[model samples]
Target: MAKPQPTDAQTDAEPENTEAAESEARDPAQALADIEAAFDAERAEMRDRLMRALAELENTRKRAEKDRREAAIYGGSKLARDLLPVFDNLNRALNAADDQTRAAAKGLVEGVELTHRELLAVLGRHGVERVSPKPGDQFDPHLHEAMFEAPVPQYAAGQIIQVMTDGFRLHDQLLRPAQVGVSSTPSG
Candidate 1:
């Protein structure tokens, strides 16, 4: 028996339908492009997230280090401040002693001097420093507290005429500001 041939209606329908079916099949190049585009988008997003997390971690580390340094520098500020008067009294005693008296009390004076020196050295080792303002230096508000403004024509205005108390510093932090008298005169 002979095989039946397709009708005209079936033939016409096949051409249109065949083209539609062929187009629906995946194109290797287009599929590869789409896959690459998706991969690229995912990689970029992940990289952005990673960089932000790293930056935040670095910032946190820096802040912690700063806090630790500050704690080390100013930990004994109250105790150190309280000891200032003892040092002042020692200095005053040494200053008031005359040569004959100092010689007679040499051993005692030397002992007190040695103790005072050792105390200052220990404080210096721990980042504590004395700020001794000179008689003619300019008065700085950050390091000097003006107790009074004196009228003196021999020095320039704002010059430190007197320093009532010495200042102290623990690293970059001020433990105490120097008590000073600023000049009111305009010229030397």
Candidate 2:
């Protein structure tokens, strides 16, 4: 008679089964405690992984919301900047008109004036505002750019002496700082 060979699966599992049976037989309560401890360790590891995933998901949500808000606020900034030169050219034309020119071409001047007003109105609707600082006013580096510094007797040092062009602001952001000359005279 030929003896049947033990199957590979049965051979591999025999040692682990024997060890468990021996442990259980030695002290049943201790074996039960060991099983409970292993389950607890696995449960803790799974709980830690779930908590980390939840935290990452929350951070991604907050970052997405912030990006959406910034896009809404500053999305048109490039177009706004491009249109600034157009506004400056229009203003220059109006400024160059003297009393003689105005009298000679009153209708033409009026048309240009109307167009300029309309342009300003359109810009205002989109949150652009002029930052025209006058001479003798305090210079604000945030809103005005110092193109030159000179000792002017009429104004104290740090005061704006002249404004070459008006600045523009869109919401809290400055599109162009007012081109200015700050006084450099020593204050008494």
Candidate 3:
């Protein structure tokens, strides 16, 4: 038997089908490389997201730790300030004791002094400090409140002439400003 010759329509259709098949066919290595490229892109995206999440978690943890430390340091500031009057009274009682009274009741005076010292020690242990500005010290508005102004020959302008009541601080925060008398130049 003889092979049949192709018609014009059949010839045209054969080339189109062969082109489609050629376009669809790919070598094994090229296909594998394309698949690897896609996988790598997905992995990189996942890694970026994970890194961002980890950074956010670390920031949150640091903020929480700082807040906890601040709370611990300043938690009792109000109560500490409220109890300052008690400290003042103790000092007043000791100061009011005259020589006759002290000599008459030596043990009582000693006991009061001891109690005052112990209370001060306790306050110091809790980071509360007495701000006692001596005479002629420079007046600091931030730590001292000027109740009055005086003029004298021995003191300069803006000097602390007297500290009426001691101030207090709790861990670098001032609970109360020291009541003071500031000195000025003698009035001409």
Candidate 4:
């Protein structure tokens, strides 16, 4: 009997079977690589989100701290401003008193002076300071408010001719601007 001949279907099926086996053999390595890539992508996304959250938290904390500091520094501003007129009145009384009357009222005058000094000292300790501009000094719009312009030949234009009210500062911030008179040259 002659050996059985291979059929056309069997011949075609043999190469296809071998190719499928080879593909199956590589599947585990491919799956592992895919899983590692997926894990890396997930980790990167999580890290980015964490960094963003941290930055936002830091910004919020800094803003809150700044607000607290400002509140503490300027909380008494209204009360302090209200008390300034009292100080002005006290000074005016002292200035108007005659020499003999001042001597006779020495104890009362000393008490007022002491009170004024104590008030100033307390204000200084809390970062309050006087802004006393001298005549002929260059007028600063940030620290001085011009109430009137005086024509003075002795001073240059825009110079401070007189201070109507002394100014005060709380730290580097202006609490009140000095009421001042500025100089202007007369027209030729």
RMSD of each: 6.4, 5.4, 5.1, 5.9
Error of 2 at 15 (Å): 12
Position 126, candidate 2: lDDT: 83
Model 1 vs. true fold: TM: 0.63
TM-score for candidate 3? 0.71
lDDT of 2 by residue, 1-188 (tens): 99999999999999999998897798999878999999999999999999999999999999999999878877877888888888898899999999999999999999989998998898888888889999999999899999999988888889999999889998899999999999997646
Pick out the ten consecutive residues of candidate 3 with the lowest summed lDDT.
20-29
Against the reference, the lDDT scores of all candidates come to 0.87, 0.91, 0.92, 0.86
Q: Write the per-residue lDDT of candidate 4 for residues 26-116, one digit (tens) a residue.
A: 5978878888999999999999999999999999999999999998998778777776777677767767778897799999888888887
Query: Worst ten-residue run, lDDT, model 4?
Result: 86-95
Q: What is the lDDT of residue 7 in candidate 4?
A: 100
Arrange candidates by TM-score, highest first: which order?
2, 4, 3, 1
Q: What are the TM-scores, per candidate, against the unseen true structure? A: 0.63, 0.82, 0.71, 0.74
**Candidate 2's C-alpha lDDT?**
0.91
Candidate 1 at residue 184, lDDT? 91
The true-versus-predicted C-alpha distance at residue 168 of model 2, in Å, is: 1.3
Answer with 1 or 2, whichever has the higher lDDT: 2
Task: Please identify model 4 stretches exceeding 4 Å from their true place.
Answer: 1-26, 68-78, 100-104
Report the C-alpha lDDT of model 3 over 57-153, residue by residue, as the tens digit.
Answer: 9999999999999889998888889889988998899889999999999999999999999988988998999999998999999899999998977
Q: Give the TM-score of candidate 4.
A: 0.74
The per-residue C-alpha lDDT of model 4 at residue 89 equals 79
lDDT order of candidates, top first: 3, 2, 1, 4
